[model samples]
Target: MPMEDAGAAKVGPDDLQAMRPHSKPNMPSPFGRLLDRATYWDLMIVASATLLVSSTYFWLAPQSQGALFEGRALTFPEAVYLSIVTFTSLGYGDVLPVGFGRVVAVLDVACGLLLTAVLIGKVASERQASLLLLLHTSDTQRRISAFAKELANIRGALSEKSESEATTKSNRAELYSLRTLTQSISNYMSFNGFQAGIVEFGNFSALSALYDELDLAFEVCSRIVHGSGKNSDAVVMARAVSCCTRIYVLVRLMSRLHRSAATRSSLFGTVLISLRLKKPASLTLAEAAAKNKSELLFQSMAIGLGKAEAWKARGYHSLQLERVLAEMPSGSKDGWGNQVHKLIAAKLGISNSVASKCVATLVELGRLPK
Candidate 1:
């Protein structure tokens, strides 16, 4: 009994396994695979060939075995005419399938219906995709145009030399507007679909123009800080620097996305060059100058605010420290005092003695603090 029990225990799992139905993965058949891989024109050609072959079969079959047109075995032209009428399910009744030809006609009708349905679906999907692309392009154009217009307003405001209370309030408003635009752009680009669409079909000229406008904004802000001498408006300069940093990061992100797309194809590189979307030598030089100016502005703001340590923590490192120091507004009130120099030296990983000497040279060159 014990031996029998052990035998049953071992055999039970095997019996259950044998009784269970095995399932194969639901892979598509060869015809289904062909349908999926074929293009619209390819499918059209296939459908045409299928219709012709069905007609030819009727024409070649024995007089008594195949379809008859007008009470007689089909001629070649009559066979084609019958095939069309049957495939469309028109049932004209002038042509009649006899014997095994009825079965062939039924199969041909099924294939014709399937291919027609597939082609119709393809047409609908293509139209939908094109409509979506058009909508995206229009939306992008509107946003870019609005962004450029806002930047132009800010530039005009900054170009003024007035120092009245009204002007100050206006400047503050413009800065706020800049921040709002930046936020809008950030939110818009955050969507994966939008990012992909832009990378694939974005207007290169509009993007280039937007970038140039942003660079101009940076230039205007830098000019205001440099021109204000030792009494530079700390609040305005700080706000401008914050906004510029965000814009710069966003620009770099867009550039990186486009660059990655370009790397995917040699054709993309050629297209970019032809469209002037790729930066030329002059544009590259302008970009470098803008970067240097931005750095100087950031460093100047940090020194004025006594936030050298905070600036260092933000991962900003000046490559052209000497030129930056030379161009920076000089004076004790702008926080270029001796003690502040030591703080700059410490945060920038420079010795106090060298920083002092550099300051001395600037002062001797008539760039004295007010």
Candidate 2:
């Protein structure tokens, strides 16, 4: 018994070896590999199978001298070509199959056509996926570029505010324009009409003016986060404005829900909520259908008052404002400032000398110093 046990327990190295060297290391089988490799060749495989089935039918069919001579009696070359053509259902009909032979040929062609279509559809679907991926990649690059520009603009605005230079009249106008650009958000929200009953935006009421300004400022930043409007130079600020509108609409619509006694999210100071969050649309840019799970997508944006501090506080600085002033009409790098002055004079119905003095007065103020 001991001798028998020892012989049975002996380990054989040969027994552990695989029949083929390419056998898998960890996986149980080649199923996944087959699927991947087969996906691309699906159409070709169908075409080949279609040809095979059609040719096989012709070859095995009751081959007698008369049957062989009839229905454009085919050899290997002709039969293979006919099989392929029939399978694809693109028969030129130069060689026709008649009677019972025609029936078999037609059946072969139909099956081949159906399988070919399925394979072609799959290929089309894959191509669409690839195109979508490319578009998503392009959008991501744009977002990165926009983010960098915003950071630079914010820095410039802050630097101007931190300066020790005297404020000039030109500087005031430049500041006003920058504020106007930032405050354009009210228009986006006006379209939504969330605040129609409670307030009218623009320079309407004394208290309303304050509310209007807030709405505009909030909208501009929101659009920036969401990437609104056309991707044009003049309309670059549209996205930021849209984001602002979305929030105003949300607050007006959800004010009661947020104010509910049991609600967890704070409703107070919710003016900046949309601004504080990233937009849903920007996230959905690549997706026709959402890849993520969420009830409201834009809430992901972080457009809060704190976020505003990063950009808004810089605008309040003096030296930075001076730089911006220098870059404005009189201080513009482009010669267009003079043309703009000429146009302004024309618009105001003023004389050439008056326009010159106005320009000089702006220069005297630190606004034109940039």
lDDT of 1 by residue, 1-370 (tens): 1232112112121322232223324634445434544566666676788789889989998877789876788888988888887787786888889987898799888988887887777677787867877887778767777777777777777643326667656765676677567657655543421233364455555555666677677666545434432233434544555555546545544554444434332333444566878743222443444344434444443353234223322222221134236444555645754486576667656666655665565566555553
Tens-digit per-residue lDDT, 1-370, candidate 2: 1232112212232321221223245632344333323444554655676678677766555553212434446776677766777776788776566556687777787777666665666577787856754664454345334433443343234211212334223333333343343334323223222211121111112222333333444544543423311111112222232333333333332222212211222222122344665322222222212112111222332345334323322322222232233334544536655466456546544455545554555566634544
Alpha-carbon deviation at 62 in model 1, angstroms: 47
| RMSD, candidate 1, Å | 20.7
- Evaluate residue 253 in candidate 1 and report its C-alpha lDDT on the 0 to 100 scale: 48
Please state every model's RMSD to the true fold in angstroms.
20.7, 26.1
Task: Locate the minimum summed-lDDT window of 10 residues in model 1.
Answer: 4-13
Backbone clashes for every candidate come to 1, 35
C-alpha TM-score for every candidate: 0.42, 0.24
- After superposition, the stretches of candidate 2 with alpha carbons farther than 4 Å from their true spots are 1-38, 63-72, 98-100, 131-370
